[model samples]
Target: MTRRVPARDVVVFTRLFATMIGAGLPLVQSLNILGRQTEHRGFRRVIRGMVRDVESGETLSGAMGRHRRVFSELSVSMVAAGEAAGALDTILGRLADFLEQHGALARKVRAALIYPAMIFAVTVPAVAILLVFVIPTFESMFASAGVPLPAPTRLVIAASAVVQGYWWALLGAVPLPALAVRRALGTSRGRLFMDRLMLSVPILGGLLRRAAVSRFTRTLGTLVASGVSILQGLEVTARTAGNRVIHDAVMSSRAAIERGETIARPLEESGVFTPMVVRMVEVGEQTGALDEMLTRVADFYEQEVDTALEALIAMVEPAMIVVLGVVVGGMIVAMYLPIFEMITAV
Candidate 1:
C-alpha cells in the first residue's frame, strides 16, 4: 500500500489525538470524531481507515505503521513504545510538540531566505532593463554623434543585443540545465555524492549536520523513554533522520549494536557523531539515563541549529547585497560611460 499521509492530515490528526487523549476519551471515539471533523478528503479517508483499524482491535501504532507514508518511522516507533508502556497520551502530546517545532524551524529557514530571493527578483529585472533599454539609448546617441564607443560600452551593447534578441531562448534555456541537474542529482550515487558535498560545505553543512544530530537524538530519546528497545529505536531513527549521511551512520550503529556492541561505540566509530555527542551517549549508557541524556543533547543541538541558521542568514544577506550592487551598478556604469565621453568631446 502506498503511504498516504497528506501534510494537513498529519497535523490535524496529531493535534486531535493529543486533545482526545488529554480529555480521557476512548481511542476509537477520538478517531471517529477526527474522521468526521477532517475537511480534507485524503485526511478524512486516513482517519476513517485508522478508525476501522482500531475497531478491529489493532493497536494505533500497528494501524499507523501500515500508513508509513503518512506516519513517519519516528512517529510510529514512538506510538508503538507509548502503546507498550501505557503512555500513549504523553507520547501523543510530545509528538504534536515535535511536529510543531519542526514546522517552525522550516518556516524560519524559509523566512530567512525570502529577503535575498526578493532582492534577486527585483535586481534581475533592474539589471536587464539597464542593459537592454537604458544602454541602447546611450549607444544610439553615441553612434549618431560619431563617437568612438569604449570597450566597456561596446561589451554592454553586445550583451544587451543578445538578451533582447534571444530573450525567449534565454527563458527556455534555464529549465534544460535545471532538469538535467535534477536528473543527475536524483540517482543514488549522485545523492550520496551530493550529501557528502553538502556536509563538507562550511556553514550550511554544519547546520545540516547539527539538525540531523538533533533529530536523531530526539527521536531515539523519545523512543527509548517510551520503552522501545535500542535496536528497534535505532532502526527507526536511522531511516527517519532525513540526512542520508546520518541515516547510513545510524544503520551502521544499529548493526554494531546487534552484534553485542554498545550503541555509543558504533556511533563514535562512525565519525558522523562528534566527540561531545559520543561522550554524552557513553555517559548516558553507563548511568542507565540514556534517554534523559539524549534528550539533553537534542535540546542543546536544537539551539545550535538555531544559532547557525541566524549566522547563515546574516552572512548571506550581505553577500546578496554586494552581488545585487555589483550587477546593477556595473550595468548602469557601462551605460553612462559613453554618455560622459560624448559630453566631454562636445
Candidate 2:
C-alpha cells in the first residue's frame, strides 16, 4: 500500500536531511522534523518508520535498506559508506546533487517531447472524429444526390465505413500493442533486444546513448567519490541503469576488473563507451584520478544531452506539425473532391 515517491521529493528530502545533519541536528531528530513536514502520506510513513528504526539502534542506511522501494541501492550504498566513514552529511549532500541532476535530465527529455506529443494527441482524435462522423455525413449527401463519387472521395468514404464498423477493434488495437510490449520487456532477452534496438533508432538513438553514458558515469563517479569500491559501484550502477545494453556493458567491465584487467579496456570492448571516454578512463586509472575523470565525462555528456535534446525538439516540432497538417489536409481534400467536381459541372 506504499505509494511511490517522486524523485524530486526524494532529492529535496535528501538535501534537507544533509543540511540538518550538517547543522548538528541528531539523525533521529532530523527525521522526526522531516517526517512531520512531509506532505506525502507514503513518504511520511516511510520517514516515521525509519525514525522508529533509528531510535531502536538500527543504522540509518540499514533502516533505509528495509524500504528498498523508496531508497535505491545507490542511495543505501552511499549512506552505508558515509556512515562507515563518519561523513554521512557529505554523502547525503552528494546523493541529493546526483538525484537533482538525474531528475533534471529526465525533465529535459520529457519537455522536449511534450509539444510533439500534445500535437499528436490532439490531431489523432480530430482525425478520428472526421473519419467517423463528418466524412460519413458527406457520403450520405453525395449518395442521395445520385452523384458518382470520385475515386478519392469513394476511398475516404470506404475508410470511414471501415472505421465505423471496426471501432471496438480500433480501440483495442491501441492498448494491445502496448500490453504486448510491456510483457515483452518483462523478459530479459526481450529487454536486451529492445534496449539494443533503441540505440539504433534515428535521431533519438544518439540522444539515448549519451544520456545512458551520462547516467552510468555520473552514478559510478558519485559512488566512487563517496568511498564505494569500483566493483561494488559498478554493480550498483549496472542494476540501476535504465538501458539493458548499458547495464550489460557495465557488468562486463566489472567482471573484467575483478580479473585484474583495466576498466577502460573492458568498457572499450563493450562498444558502449566512446573512444574519448575510454582514453579518459585509462589516463584516470594511471594517475589515480578515475573518480574525477568519470565525473568530467558525466558533465560533458550531460551537456551533450542538453544540446541534443534542444536540436531534437527544434526538428520534431516542425516535423510533427507538417505531418499532422498533411494527414488532416489530405483527408479533407479527399472528402471534398466530389463536391467540388459536382459544383463545377453545374
- In terms of lDDT, which candidate is strongest? 2
Per-residue lDDT tens digits for candidate 2, residues 78-181, read 99999999999999999999999999999998899789889999998998999988998998898899888878888888889999999899888989889988
Instruction: Estimate every model's Cα lDDT from 0 to 1.
Output: 0.83, 0.93
Model 2 spans > 4 angstroms off: none
Query: In lDDT terms, how accurate is model 2?
Result: 0.93
What value does the lDDT take at residue 199 in candidate 1? 87
TM-score of each model, in listed order: 0.90, 0.97
Judging by TM-score against the true structure, name the best candidate: 2
lDDT score at residue 75, model 2, on the 0-100 scale? 99
